[model samples]
Target: MSVVAVLRLPLAVDLSGFVKLLQRMQVPHRVSEEAGEQVLWVPDEISEDVRSLYARFPAGDPDQQLELPASGRTSTRPGFVQQLKASPITALVLLSSLIVAAVTLLGENLETLRWLTFLEFRVVGDYIQFTPLGDSLAAGQWWRLVTPMLVHFGFLHIAMNGMWYWELGRRIEARQGGINLLGLTLLFSLVSNFAQYVFSGATLFGGLSGVLYGLLGHCWIYQLLAPNPAYHLPRGVLVMMLVWLLLCLSGLVSLIGFGEIANAAHVGGLLVGCFTGLLGGLFARRKMAL
Candidate 1:
């Protein structure tokens, strides 16, 4: 049996130390086309033997890297700094903070620029009044297709979505590379978000929520179907999502209020994401078979 460890290396490598790792582990390995990544094959028969040897890896494959913002005090302690540099946790924290700051500073204007969390169809009244021009554009509006997603109604909305994107995006960027992540996000955003406005006859649309949820759904679905998602999602995530749905049903959470999780967009994005993941997995399998 073998457990494969895929590593997305830091910008800088401690060559001497990596050599020591290969010697210590006595395992076979291959470097990726880019010096930034590697794949290590580990022996299945082991009792936590790989923990120290493998903790250096970002996390899982395709989209698994450190949690971001690689934290804690790293040292001259050979190999220590190397691992910290690859942490996704540190990167995520920094990105979240930056987005929060930008959202906070943008003040009210953030709303007009991009849709935050709630879908345009969810908050139809306020949005319609807010963007009357969107009305003229609504009758078979083509530009709204892309513009709506860029318009957010609130600061937190952008922060939440942006933060997730920076973190998860980096991982997926590491995996399928930036091109695919960007492509998928754009595809899901345009297709699902636009579908909702069209279905509800919504003249005005706003927020990153639809796309945010789409990205989340994409990550969750891919992880579930693809073998791993960095770390497994706790039962808590499921319950939290359900509770959010219930809140939408109860009208307690606004966008998520009164069946407003863009149940349509949510379903559409989710279905798309699930199928995308399945399809992506098939591609991986075929590539392996080849």
Candidate 2:
């Protein structure tokens, strides 16, 4: 676990391309600020290779071509932040979630909650009554279908979802483009929210867990079929999430005081995401062939 500095660069110079290169090469690394400069650290064993790569970085040779492992062509892609800015869909989804969570924290505010939730329901003594807000949808308040994805119930809920969304959504946006990520988010949210409503039987439930599961599923399947560095995920993460899903569905989470789990939403999101990933992966493979 000993990490050593492999390369040092001035702060003004962008390191995103270099970082992406390392990621593509499956090299473990960490970047830290030191002495008014950025230091790239890697395992001691890979330090020399990293140093050698830096010595002949593509920036130094305008005429030389940079060939990625799988592809023979060079890519003149911008850095990560610049790419994110160019495609703001992921940022929009993340910001919407944060804003919704903040507004929810203002108070119990039943009116606001009803507006944001996928479907409003009320308990009628022995039976649960459901209302699907037909008027709102007819009035072009179509945001209701997807708004539930942003309705985080607590601080931890929002924080976890935000982190996952930032990580997964950014990766998707960077590789597949903003529109693809936006479409996937919308599809996942719609399916998961509706599934939750159907299974939970007019109960109040809201969070991004379902969408996060969809992202996870998409990444997992895409990495499997496409085998790209951008979609890489640690095996442990996949195992942990799958185990947690099983635990939730098994009713163990509720017994353990984890509160109500949206098992159906998670299932629905994962299924839809897997389907999307399958289609996307096949298309990518065909495009590469072309």
Candidate 3:
């Protein structure tokens, strides 16, 4: 059978532990060195499986001594630089969110935050004065459509959203590609932001929670349609997010001091996400059948 290179790591990187996992899984592969890089080749058919494993444990895990058919146990996690290289788009989003959070002082600094908010606003002595939506849009401020995803409101808000995005964004990016992931993210943000603006009505609100739900829905439905092991999410993860969504919609989360919940954005993002996943999974299923 023909083989393809699934990974190309720097010369200094070690995959001894990953190799052991491959051996345990009985995946046929070969490792070679070329021009100071380590290249891993596997059968073309199982390339996705092998690459998914490598992305999970780039340096391999040493503590996983148990023999499993296919395990996601970590040996030595990849270094920070390696992670950045592995998922640059995810890293960029997180970094941009961090910068926006800092500059906006968690949405306290209205002057700096106004540019990223969905609507234009002014600081009027401890209060905000919002410009009409039509005015802002007509002024060629198109970036406002999606920049709201970057303007988080609090520490816990950004933290939770960032963590979720990191988990879900990288999974899609690893399987599809950076461009696909970026496009999905932008689409999610645009829809979610607009939904929030319509439902909440010109008030101050911003976070990645809606987009996180989008990613979650994408992976959740995509896996169901295509049944790819790489896209499989834990049952507990699915339950937790769904429960949280329900609670947010019921207003319990907001009533309990977690702040106002963007129920419309979350629901809108999830709806669009499921639709996209259906389309994508159907296409992939068809391609595989051919």
- Tell me the spans in candidate 2 whose CA falls farther than 4 Å from its real position: 1-87, 121-130, 133-136
Clashes of 2: 0
Worst 10 residues of 2 by lDDT: 58-67
CA lDDT for candidate 1: 0.50
Compose the digit string of candidate 1's lDDT tens values, residues 187-257.
Answer: 77677776676565534444445555565566666656454434245667656755664565465676443
Scored by TM-score, the top model is 3
lDDT at 113 for candidate 2? 74
Compose the digit string of candidate 3's lDDT tens values, residues 15-59: 888998787777888999998899888876676667657777766
Error of 3 at 235 (Å): 0.5
Error of 1 at 266 (Å): 2.6
Model 2 CA lDDT for position 222: 77
Measured by TM-score, how close is model 2 to the native structure?
A: 0.68
Candidate No. with top lDDT:
3
Distance from true location, Cα of 286 in model 2, Å: 0.9
TM-score, one value per model:
0.54, 0.68, 0.77
Off by over 4 Å in 3: 1-76
Clashing pairs in 2: none
